[model samples]
Target: MRGLSVTETCFAIPGDIDSPTGGYGYDRRLLTMLPSFGVNVRHLELPGTYPAPSQGDLAATVDTLNSAPPNSTLLIDGLAYGAMPSSVIEKINRRIIALVHHPLALETGLSERRRAELEASERAALALADKVVVTSPATQRILEADYGVAKDRVTVALPGTDPALRATGTGTPLQLLCVGTVTPRKAYDVLIEALLPLKHLDWRVNIAGALDRDRETVAALNAQIAAAKLEDRVSLPGVVVPATLDRFYESTDLFVMPSRFEGYGMALAEAMARGLPIICSTGGAAAETVPDGAALKVPPGDVAALTKALESALTDKRLRVRLADASWEHGRSLPTWNETARRVAAAILDIPT
Candidate 1:
């Protein structure tokens, strides 16, 4: 093996570069910022069907890793790394850093056999890495407690929030926004159930995310909305472009994310960054992301609590303002993208800053 190169690192990511999700956003932001910190990041595009890779995909991944220059530092995105076998790990001679957005097994809708397999595979994969980087402290704790990863081996690099215009809600009918992919993990069903009883309230909701990810859930949700006669009050606009999403944030009065789990609640942070008040589930990293008293939180999958919180936020104008104010203050306190990149670079380069 050759001696290590201190100024360059390779990042391996699966799926499309344009995927509009938080984990993808994190990788994109980091790749954009790492070069400024004097580390040349080479992005290695892995096959899309990770965590369920075909034999061909696995062979391609093995070829990619085996072909990397010896002693080079490789940062593998968890989606690809978590499913990799130890035989593959043994073939790579370079230092490896695993970037875990969240564990694979925590994803919703997995069968017991699949979950156990993922848990075991991920544990083995993480064990093979030289360092592990998690996006939030909540995720870090989960690894240490549940996955048997040592606390010292893990580093937390919280996702960054860009500065944006604060929302100026249309006063007549309050605008509530939910930004996340429509999947079982997001618990849009719970959100829909919560919104069902609030039809009399002068408010409208827009769920902006990739509905194509789960067609069955999307169809069921559509049916639920139709059956409840909420066609006018609720809308699912599918994947939103940046300009349109900004407009939604700019005009929104409140943001809600009823996710059952998150490695880091990037959408929630974005909303807070834009000074939108929040009502989110206390699932995974959410409670840690939003400051205390800044937003209301309920146990995940608790429809009644979510409904009650929504009701309070809608009915009381002062409560909304107070939450928004606190949220804005907390949002201002989050680290910027460059800072996050710098932290990761420091971890990658073994530099203290």
Candidate 2:
């Protein structure tokens, strides 16, 4: 990390770097792993009010990026980068690299006008970057077709999955799990609805994520669960520790992601790492992230479809076994953290002298 040959790269991130979310996890991994590949990373913490930052916050964000070493590369997280004013973007002097976890406009619950505004802002910011790094090919295509980014200007770096022992599920009561922030984008309410008619079955649900990110969504989901009389059947444990999350995966009978969309399904990959059977939506890049052999695919937002997939997985142990076997194989083949870092370092080194 102290070597003179390493590229000086600063990561411009908004919000808690330790927050239990996939995008932050990716950034954190790069900060630690990039140095292993001869790239020295400096963390630039920006205001947490991103995708809707105030004017003052925008000024601070620009100041932070501009403060990086004169020869350093400014690697901005898309959460803040995509929403910055074009005028603000024109001020940064460092070599720029944008890490687009996904387009801001794709988040669920944004109004049409808001979506359009975000799309415009992101497109503009992406246009100015020296390089753009994406998590998946599906997102690369999205940028190519919709964001107007040149195909050659972007780098595809898949998120890594840690190796894990195959799960030994508890059959006494089938455990269904979903790991992600409890935002509208995750479609937790929709998952609740899909689980309603299946109350008579022997099963439990754990939707573990940060509930603080969207209080209204959490409150609405809680009310929905109570009204459906699933208070005892479903649990919202908020954010669990890494060890606890691993235990949840180890004991899970089926992994479910009813997300409306995903830039890349990191949780899906984690579940696969544990060789757990999956039932995920074909939302955003999800359909392409999880192989058909490992999951029962359903269109995002279709409660009926999700319910059908859930029912089949619950009753058919043989089906789960086949899916889990495929999952184990696929999980073993998923990328590692060092590889992810190598690609990010390569993207950083590619910046002009």
Mind giving the per-residue lDDT tens digits that candidate 1 earns over 159-263? Answer: 888987777887679999999888899998898899888888999999999988779989998998898888898899999899999999988988999999988
Where is model 2 more than 4 Å wrong at Cα?
Answer: 1-7, 351-353
Whole-model alpha-carbon lDDT for candidate 2: 0.91
Q: Tell me the alpha-carbon RMSD of every candidate.
A: 1.4, 2.9
Residues forming the 10-long window of minimal summed lDDT in candidate 1: 1-10
Candidate whose lDDT is highest: 2
Per-residue accuracy of model 2 over 122-229 as CA lDDT, tens digit each: 999898888899999999999999999999889999999888999998887999999999999999999999988898899999999999999999999999999999
Model 2, residue 309: C-alpha shift (Å) = 0.8
Q: Which pairs of residues collide in candidate 1?
A: none
Pairs of residues at least 3 apart in sequence or in different chains that clash in candidate 2: none
Residue 248 CA error for candidate 1 (Å)?
A: 0.3
Q: lDDT of candidate 1 vs native?
A: 0.89
